[model samples]
Target chain A: MRAACHAPIRGDFTGLRGLEWDKMLHCPAQAARAIPTISAATSMSQTRHVFFISDGTGITAETLGHSLLAQFPDTRFRNHRLPFIDSTDKARDCVQRIKDAAIESGIRPIVFNTLVDPSAVAALREADALFLDLFEKFIEPLENELGQRSTHAAGRFHGIADSQDYKKRIEAINFTLAHDDGVSHADLAEADVILVGVSRSGKTPTSLYLAMQFGIKAANYPLIPEDFERNRLPVELTRYRGKLFGLTIGPDRLSQIRQERRPNSRYASLENCLHEIESAQRMMKREGIKWLDSTAKSIEEISTIILQEVRLDPQSY
Target chain B: MRAACHAPIRGDFTGLRGLEWDKMLHCPAQAARAIPTISAATSMSQTRHVFFISDGTGITAETLGHSLLAQFPDTRFRNHRLPFIDSTDKARDCVQRIKDAAIESGIRPIVFNTLVDPSAVAALREADALFLDLFEKFIEPLENELGQRSTHAAGRFHGIADSQDYKKRIEAINFTLAHDDGVSHADLAEADVILVGVSRSGKTPTSLYLAMQFGIKAANYPLIPEDFERNRLPVELTRYRGKLFGLTIGPDRLSQIRQERRPNSRYASLENCLHEIESAQRMMKREGIKWLDSTAKSIEEISTIILQEVRLDPQSY
Candidate 1:
């Protein structure tokens, strides 16, 4: 059912009409509504070009496309994207490419800016595309609507026992404890589940996966030498011994995922990553906390196993 | 991420095995590799008390709970759903309660065996909680592969071209041709955009939304005049069309969606659900057509809107 996004927003009016846009000065919302009609009234309507552009992998533009289609169900789409490059030149190039296509095909296109580069945004403005700048308008409303978020997970351990889910729930609490999300936590007792892993041990995806797929409410904290040197779980973790779960990965694969995210960074090197994975494994063993090696396993497998093994299942929707 | 499923099917223990299993039988595939081990393990693992059943409104177990997470990415979850109800008495009660909970929860609970009855399935077997049975096994598999499917549908419609997307691609050729998987023809072409409106239009979710979403190669065949003369859209439409979208509603709501479904169904009268919805809406808007009502909008909304605007993003993983 997945399809490319190609629908135009029908935003600007390329039509030459003195009275067509008189409705806009009356109310911006109404003006926005009239845009589609005015454009439909003119030959220029079919001359526009549309594209879904982004500065960050274009994920946001894809989302905006979904939302726009929801608004205009009948409109046909002609989608295009300029990947990785975030220059005004790229943006203008995108506009021209789409324009060329529209001229040939007789269909206008809309440019959806989902986090396009700041400068590129200006380029879109100069282009003849009907651009709908989403990032600028979405942030505050999204923030206010969602409020302070705890976790963005959705699972209810149905066939799985409550106890099994709860185990994962506690482990997630600990994982969350170890990770930082601009939140403050003074002690392990305050944690629901704590995650212990050496640096780059697939912690973030595993933790997020746990919180999301299983609603384990996970937080991950990287294990470093100081804690191992002391031969102890973090001081905070001692108070919530039952709530901790550990994630480990094979030395080689651990290095790969990290390297991709941050190439050549000291932390992402195979040697460094392997050192941490090994040390974290030893630390978990010494501490008697059960852990799993995530090297070969998919993140889903790793997180779900942790969720089940640790038995932490947060029930909130 | 999707590769794990094709992991050469090695027969050994999987990550699912908890710490307590005997080392010799640790590997699930390997342990089960031999028939004796399977028999022994089967005998040893006693049955449990609960059964969670669902007389499906229509969805597969895996796709329902797990896939539901895609809609709200931020909501974390710990979900489990039992499979087909096995033949057992104790299972029925368990199934009933869970079914009740599901009804209350208001999400599109996944289902299997559209033709089977939960109670009847229980009767087929004599067990404690047979009502909820078919689903028990899949939970592990799903958990075992969470993140692989869970990037919030990360790249569902990435990089797809508009012309290639189903709606635009399949627009003109919706001939009443029989195809596998129960889709029909007029249902196809007439469905280039088909809105199955029930009174008050039910927002014509089932049919219209699907067109909007995936471009499922859509074809919407309205329930017009044959039901009206017999009055439905023309009989030829039934014989040949693209997608058939359906919109239904509560008795009172029927008037509303029906007004939109066509704004006219003699069957839309209050207290006449059987005649209006079941009869006109059912009895095959045309033979072998799928539908949804405004009353069933939430579910249809899930099916329709999702199917309506599929962003043909290139596969992310």
Candidate 2:
């Protein structure tokens, strides 16, 4: 069964503009009053129920499910995440919860499942919903191509299978913490990547992400005004020229970000931000260090670009 | 265009056991020699090439693709991630890269694409690979269910859409950093969850994961010998009893973890680990705080369980 019925248009008609803009500016109350006739005409469902169930952490299921749901911008989805459903009893309970959501929504709920255990999957298959068995759909094709059967193991993806890899990730996190903000030169040579940026230009979070997610020992150094006056990179960083990557933010965004930390301070002024960014860019160019603008991108985007631009293999790290 | 032909078995015969065992112990050299006759007989292909292409960071495509590939454990896949493929020019360049991979590997490459732009998707369709368009497959069904045409936007999943949400994530990161290891008690009241655990028991990484992934303000405190000696919870944590969550690790695992940090020290001894764990468990039970074992679970699993146990809505944070 599928939830093909139309739902009530609860929000703004501005969405109908079909242009990409800031969604946070969307005022629901004003939208409701702006298109009363359309809202009155469409009234079949309230909210669609979406469930992401997995044998492990359900991160993959939730991520893929969310990406699919984002395609429909006007629809409201009430999401339910059921992770670590490895046992048949837990799967049975999951089926009950999904059935309840289906009944509550007056339509079949959409389920994105990544359960690998046969018994648990069999139990969850009893649920009356649009069951999108993510693992089952792709495993057969992969098995055929590989000329082998899958392990059908539960919790393998996110599980700590390799002790060495797990230890590396933990060590990387500790290394990053100890080396944060140029606090330690003890292990500068051990770092896989070193980030340089003006204060609050998104160095710490990016370094943490590289360490936590990819097991890359990332060290970050703040490019202060002293370096700008000297017209040179930090003396400590000169030895690791190949590992250095720069982050630059737009002056306006940098100023706004700084204002939150220090209200009405000279450091938070737009002129200071502009000067700092220009100097950082010039130094990076002189040092032949590749850099990117962090003003409009998320940390994930910035990290991925850094990895590609620096040609750093995360797996090797 | 699918590469359905069998590939040469390069790894060990022990994988034929089909039993859940330590994959890290599977020595490829031994496996290659053990199955020499079978390896000699099969000579169709060497390795398969896979690409993850998207308009944004391509994280979702890479994640889902990795999950699918994990099902085929015996096969070797060469992965190429191409992010920010937003224009037709970039998509055409991406097709050339895939074609080059196909030529190099002597097999048709597998492409997992999440490009939303119609022109870019069309340009990528010219590639000679098993094109698995993730967004296209699900968007049409979603559009039918929602009874509206999709905006066909790109980079919506990981893009910083809401400035408020972005700020909350940054603030959460900062809050978790400041509160790490009980360094600060200034904003304990603002925390959504506070984790208590012995040192090296996986508290810091889990706290950071909670902050980074969900934007939930998490503070973690280390339970030291003083608290165990006193046989009570910390006085500062007594007021916010409802937000307390405990993490315990297996004594053996804890000892090994500590030994890496401080070798041959009394703190890393097995006896000390056992006593600390027992005392922490007793204190947690006495205080009626919920807790979990963090020895075998990843930070993602532990964080998800903590959120569920505490009934903390990450979205609300």
Best by lDDT, which number? 2
**DockQ numbers for every candidate?**
0.02, 0.18
Q: List runs of model 1 lying over 4 Å from the truth.
A: A1-183, A313-317, B1-317
- For model 1, residues B1-317, the per-residue Cα lDDT tens digits are 12211112111111121122221111122112221121222221122112223322111223222222232345433244332222344244433433433343332222222113335554434332122222222222222322122121111111122324432422322221122122454234333434443333433223322332233333333343346446445454554433444444456655543454354556554555434555555444344333433342232223422232222222111
Query: What's the lDDT of the predicted structure labeled candidate 2?
Result: 0.74
List each model's interface RMSD. Answer: 20.3, 14.2
Residue B86 accuracy (lDDT) in model 1 = 26
Write out the backbone clash pairs for model 2.
B12-B31
For each candidate, the alpha-carbon lDDT, in order, equals 0.40, 0.74
Cα error of candidate 2 at position A190, Å: 0.8
lDDT of 2 by residue, B79-156 (tens): 777777778887887777677666666888888889999999999999888877778767776677667898888887
Which ten residues in a row are the worst by lDDT in model 2 chain A?
A1-10
